[model samples]
Target: MFPDHTSTHADTAIAPGDDTEHHEGNPRPRAMTSTAEIDSTISHPGSVRINVKGAFIVDSTEQPATPANGNSTVNGSYHEGKDIRLPNHTAVVSHIAVDIGGSLAKLVYFSREAHSTEPGGRLNFHSFETDRIDDCIDFMRHLKDNQLALNGSKPKDLCIMATGGGAFKYHDKIKKALGVDVLREDEMACLIIGLDFFITEIPREVFTYSETEPMQFVEPQADIYPYMLVNIGSGVSILKVSGPKKYERVGGTSLGGGTLWGLLSLLTPANSFDDMLEMAAQGDNAKVDMLVGDIYGTDYNKIGLKSTAIASSFGKVFRMKREAEDEAEDNANVAQDHPQLDQKVHASSNNATSSSQPRGLNDMSSRFSASDVSRSLLYAISNNIGQIAYLHSHIHDLSHIYFGGSFIRGHPQTMNTLSYAIKFWSKGQKQAYFLRHEGYLGAVGAFLNRQPQNWGRRGSFEGDGAALEDRLRARTSEH
Candidate 1:
C-alpha cells in the first residue's frame, strides 16, 4: 500500500498443456470431476485459470447478461454470461481462496456479475477472521446464494482453494456449505506463488526501508541468482529459489505474525490490526521486550548483531520491578492528565513504538502503534526466514527471493523489516521483494489449470473454423 522498500531487482514462467493445435471446441479444460475424463459429455470453456508457478487464482466468469439481459453487477464487474450454450444453465466461478493465517482468515471470492461496458468481470473479494470458521463459511454461502439468485448457477462448480493450517481443519465445512470442489495447496507453495505473481504483476508494489529514501522496487527478476521466498503470513516460511522452476522450502518458524497478533489481542485492548498499529504507534515496547543488555550485560560486538536487539520480545514483562512500572505508570498518568507534563514530554520530542514506523508508508502505516512491538515481531520472523533462505541459496547456489501471502499485505513493515534483515544478514549480498496482489496466487493457478495447452501463451490461439481448416490442410498434405 505504501512506496517500495529501498533495494533492487526478479523472474517466473507458468504455461499449461503441450501445444497450440487444439481440438475444434476443447480449449479451456474444466478440471475434470474426480471420476470423469475429457470425453463426449462436457465440451465448453471453463472460467478458471491459475498459473502453477505462483499458484495465482484468477476467476473470470464472463456472463453475457447485459442491459439486454437481466443481471446485477458483482464486485464492480458483471458476470457476463455463465452458459452461452444453454442460456438456462447459469455459469459462474464462485471460488473461495481462504488463507487462514495465525491472526485472521483472509477469504477472497467472486460472487456477482457486471453487465456494464467496463472491462474485467464483476468479481467480489472479501475476508473474515480465522477463528470465525463458521462465519467465513456462511459468508461463502451468502455469495453462492447471491450468485444463484441472480442466475441458477451450479454451486458444485464454485471454485474453493485453501491454504495454511485450517485448510485441512475446515475442509468439510467449505465443501458442505457450497457443494463445490475443494482444492488444497501447500501453504508454503501458495505463499511463494502469491508473492511471485504480485511482484511481477503490480508495478507500484514495494516496501520501504532506511527512511523510505531510494525505496526498493518489488523486482522479482533483478536477482543476485537464487534467493529465498520468506512468507510471513499467519506463520513464517522460507523457500530458496534456485532456478526458473527449481526451489526448495528450506525451513521456517511457526512463530510469526500469528504470534504477534494473538499476543497483542490478549495482552492489550487492540481490536483490529489497524488498531494495534495505532496503539503500538505510541506504546513503549522496551517496557515489554527484552534487550541485549539484559542478557549479556555488554555489547557482544564480535558479530554485528546488537545487544539492544530484542533478545526475547516481552521478556522484560517478567523482569521489570513492579515499583518502577507503577511509578512509571503514575508519571505517565501525571504527565498526560496534568497537561504540563504532557506538554514537556511532547516538547522533548521522544518517539516510542507508538507511531514509530519507517518513513514513506501509506496512511495504514505498519501493523499497530506498538511499531516497536510490530517491528520486533517482524524482525523475529523475517530474520529467521532470511537466514534460512540464505543458507538454502548458498547450498543450492541460487539468487532470487520472492516473499508473499496475506501476511505481507497486512504488514508492509514486516516486509521492509524482512528485506532489510535479509540485506544486512547477507552483508549486502542478497535482497528481498514484496508483491502487490499478495493473495491471488493459488486462485490464479487453479484458474489457469483449466485452460487448454495453447490457451495460456499469447498469440497461440486458433480460430473456431478458419484456423482449423488451414491446420488440417497442412496435416493432410504432410500425410
Candidate 2:
C-alpha cells in the first residue's frame, strides 16, 4: 500500500452517534490462525503478497496473556492499563478513529476502566499496511464485537471516525466488514489537532535531537503559536500552525518517504521499509556518496565545504565505475567457474525473501553492499527533506519545526540527519524535534475529533507552561 496522493483538504462530517460509553470485562478478540505467505518472485521488487485467514477469534480459550498493566498483548504490542471505565456500564462511549494512508493504516481508540466517569482512558494505537485493509478491519471488528459482548450496550447507531484518502477509498469495504458506518474526517485538520493534543498532554511526547547529545524532552510552549508541522509520509506536507484551527499549507515536497522506499527497493535486497532502515544503521554512505574530498582531493575551504561533506548523492557509483565494473567481472568469472553452485544459489534466492518482505533477489550488488546503498539513500532523502524544511522555516519566520509521520519510526540516522541539516542551515538558530508517537498523530487527531469539546484546546489544560518547562529541564538533567 502507498500513501494517498489526492490533495483534498475539505472537512466533511457524515454521521455522528450517541454519547455511548463502554465498560470493562468484555471479550477480547484473538487471532485463531493468522499466517502470512510471501510471494516467490525475483523479478519484481515490491511484489510481496500476504494472506491471512480466520483472524479475530473471540473465544475465551484463545485470549492472550495480559501483562502487569492488565492490558492484552497481541503481536508483541503492549498497551498500558491506563484505561478509564464508567460505572454500571451505562451506555458507554466507545469511539474508534482511523487514519488510512497508502502505506500504513493507523487506528486509535479509547478504553477506560469500570466505574470511571473521568475524561481519560488508555489511548491505544495499532497499524497495518493499507493494502492489508482486511487485517485492520478484522481487528476493528474484533474490538467492536468484544465491546458489545461485554457491555451489552448496543446502540441504535454506531460509526467509526476515519480520516485520510484510504477512508474514502475503503469506505464501503470498512462498512461491510465492521458493520458500522465510517465517519470521515479531514486529514490535515486531524493531523494538526492530534499534534496539539499529545504535545500538550503527554509529558514525554516531544523531544529535540541536539547533535551527539541524548534527546531532551521539550515542554509544551505556553505561546505555542507559529510552529510548523512537517509530516513525512509517502510524501511530505509542511503546515504552518499559527493557533488552534488556524494553519496554512505553506509548502511540501514530492520527494519524501515514498521516494526513499522506491529507490531503496531498486538498489537493496530489503523488502520492508523498516528492514531498509535497519540496513542503513550498519551502512557507510561515504562509500556510495561522492564526498568533497573525493571531488577536490581536499576540503574546499574557500567554499566552507568539509572534506567529508557529501558532494553528490550516489555520485561515487559513477565516479568509481571502473572498480564496480571490475567487481562485476570478477563475480561473473566466479559464477562461470562453478555453474552448479551458481544455479543452486539462484534457486535459493528465488525461494527466499526478507522475513517481513515479499520479494527476493539474488542480485545483491558486488560493487557495493546493501548497507552502503541503504545508507546513501537514507542520507539523500533525509538531507533533502531537512533542507526543504529549513528553507520553509526561514521563509515563514518559524522557529520550531516538528517532524512526524510513519517514515521516521524513531530512526536515529534519519533524525540525526534532519537535525544536522537544520543546525547547519539555520546556524543553530533552530532545532528539529521529533514526536514519540509520530505515526499515530493523524489517527489520534481523528480520535480527538470525537472527544468532548475543548478536549484538545490549549485553554482546556490547567498548568503553567513555563513552570512545566523548568520541571522537564530538571528531569532531563537528572536522567
Candidate 3:
C-alpha cells in the first residue's frame, strides 16, 4: 500500500552559455511582490542526484498587472518579441506535463534558470484536488505565459500530455481553461514508465518497511526486471513489469485506498485520509477485532494460529451486543432494587458496547472510537491487498513486490501491515517495498512516456530525442 509521498527529482541539462540578452522595454521597476513558495529540487547539470537543500525560485515579479476584474488578462495582451526582464536577467525554459486523476491532479514540469552560474535545471512537482482542476489550469497558464515573456518567442503549440480517468472525463474543461490541446496517454503505460524512471534514475527512491525490523532502503538494481507492482490508488492495479515500456495487467482489486477512505470516513470523524491514518497508529485494534484468544480462551497452537491473531475484524461488536442484550433481559427479570443487576446492566451497555460497538444499529454515539475503527479498516485493506499480491507473485514466480499508490503514504502501520501480510504469506520468501513518491507515479509515467523507449538506460534526457517537446507546449492565441 503506497500512501502519499511527494518527493520528486528530475535529470535536466541547462544549456551553459552567456545569459545576458538585450531587451527593449523600459518600464519603471515595480516593487518586488512576494509570491507563493514552491517546493522543488534542482539537479546539477547532467547529474542524476537531486540537491534538496538548494532553493529554486520562480520570480513572480514579472507577472502582468491584475486585471480590473481580478483575472489574468486576456491572452491578446501578450505579444511576441516583448522583452519581459526575468530575475537574474535570465530566461526560464520550462516544459509542463500533468496527470489528472479521480482524486488528485499531479504536475511535473522542468525549468532552467537561463544562467550558467545556476548550472542545473529545476524539476518542480505540484498537485491539486481533481475537483479544483481550474486551479491546476491557472497555475500552468501562468507558467506558460511566463515562459513566453522570458524568451520573446511565440508560445509553442505543445499539447499537454495527460493520463488517468480525468484525462478523458475533464478534457474539454482543461482545454478551455488552459487553451492547450490535451494529449491522452494510456494510464497503465504511464504507470510503468514512471516506475521505470524511479527504479533506474532516482537514488534511494524505494524502500522496504517492517514493524519488527527498522525500515530499510531497497536499492534499485540495474538489472531489476520482472518485478510485481501493486499500486494502491483509488483502486489497486497490479502489473507485471518485465522491462521498460513492457508490462501486463496481471491482477488487481477494487477495494484499495478508495475503500479505506470511503469506509473509514463513515465510521470516524477524521476529515482527511492522513488524519485517519494518524489516528490508526494510536489505536488498539484488539478492542474491536475478535481474536483467537477471545474465542478459544487460549492459543490455538494445534493449527499454529497465535492467540493474538485476528479471528474476525470488527467481529467483537456482535458478540458484545448479544452479551449486553442477554444481561438486559436478565436484569428485567430481577428485582428493580437488585443492586448487582443494575450494575451489570449499566456496565454491559455503557462500557462494553461503548468500546466494542462504536457505530451499530444503536445510537450514533455508540460509533467505535476513531482510532480503533481506523486501525481495523487500515489492516483490513492492507492485509487483503498484501495477501492477493503475494499469491499472484507466488503463482508467477515473481520475487520482488513494490507497493506504490496513495494508500501507504509512509504510514508506519499501513506499511507494516502490508509488509507483515506479504511476509506471512510468502513465509520468508519475499518482502514488500514502497516508492518514495508513491502518489505521483502516474504523472511521472505520463512525463516519461513522452521519452524514447531506450531513454531510461541512457541516463541522460538530451540528444536521444525531444520526448516532451511535442506534448509539453504552450497554447496559441486564438484571436
Candidate 4:
C-alpha cells in the first residue's frame, strides 16, 4: 500500500562519518569514464519493486557493457578482498543478483560512493526490468562495454543470483550472455533469506495496525529466530524459517498471483494484471460470482449460512452481465431528457449504469484507464491468500507470519486486505509481517552467500570474491 517510493527515502544507512578509509592497498585511482560514449539507449537503476510474483528489485543506476565489446558483461561482475576486513571490494562485479521469472528478468547491483575497496560507505542498490529476456541480455552487454570503456574501470567478478523456474533452464544463456556464473538458489530459500533480512534490518519498512496510526514496525530484537514464511509469487510457497540457513518447506497452494492474473486475462478484457484489478474494482462479483441463493433458494439455517452465499464456484454469470451496454443507450437518453425529480422513482428501475458489467470480455482492448483494477486484483489475491495463510498458521500452531516475495511490494489494499483477513481469521492473534525489499531476497542471499552460515561451514561461497582479491594483490603488488 505504500505508494510514494521517493528515492529521497530508502532503507539504508552509512553511520554518518563512519566512512573515511579506502582499501589498505590498491591500484592507482582511475578516472571515471563517460558511459555516454559507450551506448546511450540503456536504463540505469532498474526496478524499485518486483511484480505480483515474489521477485526482487533490479532497478539501479548501474549498467553492463555490450557483448561485441568482449569484456563488458550485462549482469555486472564480482570481486574479493585481500583480507576479510571491514570494508568489502565489489567494483569488479558487474551484476550482483538476478532473478528470471516467466515473463521478466530482474537485475540488482550495489552502488558505492568509493570503490568496494573503500572502507565504510553506503551501498546504493538498484535493479533493471524488461518484459523480454533478450532486452536484459543486451543491457548487460551494454554495461560491460561502458565499464571497460571507462578510463580505468576494470571488469570485476560477478555472481548471478538467480531464482524461479527460469533459473535452472536459463542458467547457461544467462552465464554466456552476461559472461558470469549463475548462483542457483532454492526459490523457497531465497524467500526465507529475504524474509529474515527484512524482518531484522529495515525499520518502518513494515507496519502493523494499532489503536493509534499504524506503527512503523520495528524489528523485534530476535524476530528472525522462527516464523512461518508465506511467499506469494507466481504461485504460493510457504516455509517455516527457523534461522538464516535453516528453514523448512511447510506448505503452499496453486491459488497465487498466476491464478488471479490468468483468470482475469481470460474472463475479463483486462490486459495487464493492473488493468484486471482496475475493472474488478468497479465490477460487482454478483454478476459473475456464484451466489448461495442460486443453489438452495434459501439460507442454510442449520449452519447459519446466509441466503446470499456463494454456494457453488463458477456456477453463474457466464455472460457475466444482465444486459449489454448498446441496449441501455435508449434508456440513458430518456432518463437524461426527463431529468426525473422523483428519488423513489429512480430506485424503481434497476439503473443500468450503476449495475452493469462491461459489454463483454472483448472490451478489454477498448482502452487502458488509470484504473483501480490493480487494487481489486490485489484484494482478491491477498484476501484469499491471507485466509489460506491464516488457515495454515492455525493448523501449524505458528504465531508469526512473515510474508516475503516479489508480489507484495507495498501494495496498500493488498496489505490491508491481508492484514484484516488474518485478524478476522485469527481473531487478532496472528499478524502478517512484510518486507520492503520484497523481491531481492535471493540476490541478497547471493550477496551474503559468502557468510559462514551459507556455502557450508568452510565458507567457499566467498571464493569468487576472495580469488579476485588475490589476483589484485598479484598485479598491483599492494597490501
- Considering lDDT, which of the candidate structures 2 and 4 is the better prediction for this target? 2
Q: RMSD per prediction, one decimal? A: 13.3, 17.4, 15.2, 15.4
Q: What's the CA error at residue 161 for candidate 1, in Å? A: 3.1
Give the count of colliding residue pairs in each prediction: 71, 19, 13, 63
| Best candidate, lDDT | 2
Candidate 4, 162-191: lDDT as tens digits: 776777887898788877667677666565
The 0-to-1 C-alpha lDDT of every candidate, in the order given, reads 0.48, 0.64, 0.60, 0.48
10 residues in a row with least lDDT, candidate 3: 470-479
Clash count in backbone of candidate 4: 63
Residue 197 deviation, candidate 2, in Å?
0.8
Residue 118's lDDT within candidate 1 is 26
**Candidates ranked, most accurate by lDDT first:** 2, 3, 4, 1
Off by over 4 Å in 2: 1-91, 113-120, 148-158, 326-364, 451-479
lDDT computed for candidate 1: 0.48
Q: Which has the better lDDT: candidate 3, or candidate 4? A: 3
Cα deviation in Å at residue 258, candidate 2? 1.4
Task: Summarize candidate 3's per-residue lDDT along 1-479 as a digit string, tens digits.
Answer: 00012122122111222122111111122222121110011111111222222222332322211112112212212111111121222222334568776666777754454553544444455666666777778877877776654333334543477888988988888788777767788898788767765665455566777655645666544566778999888899999977645689999999998888888878889866656877898898898898999999999988877898888988887777776666555545563557676556557664444323322344423545789888988888888998999999998899889888767766777787888888888888997878656766787666544532222233333323233221111000000
- Backbone clashes in candidate 1 total 71
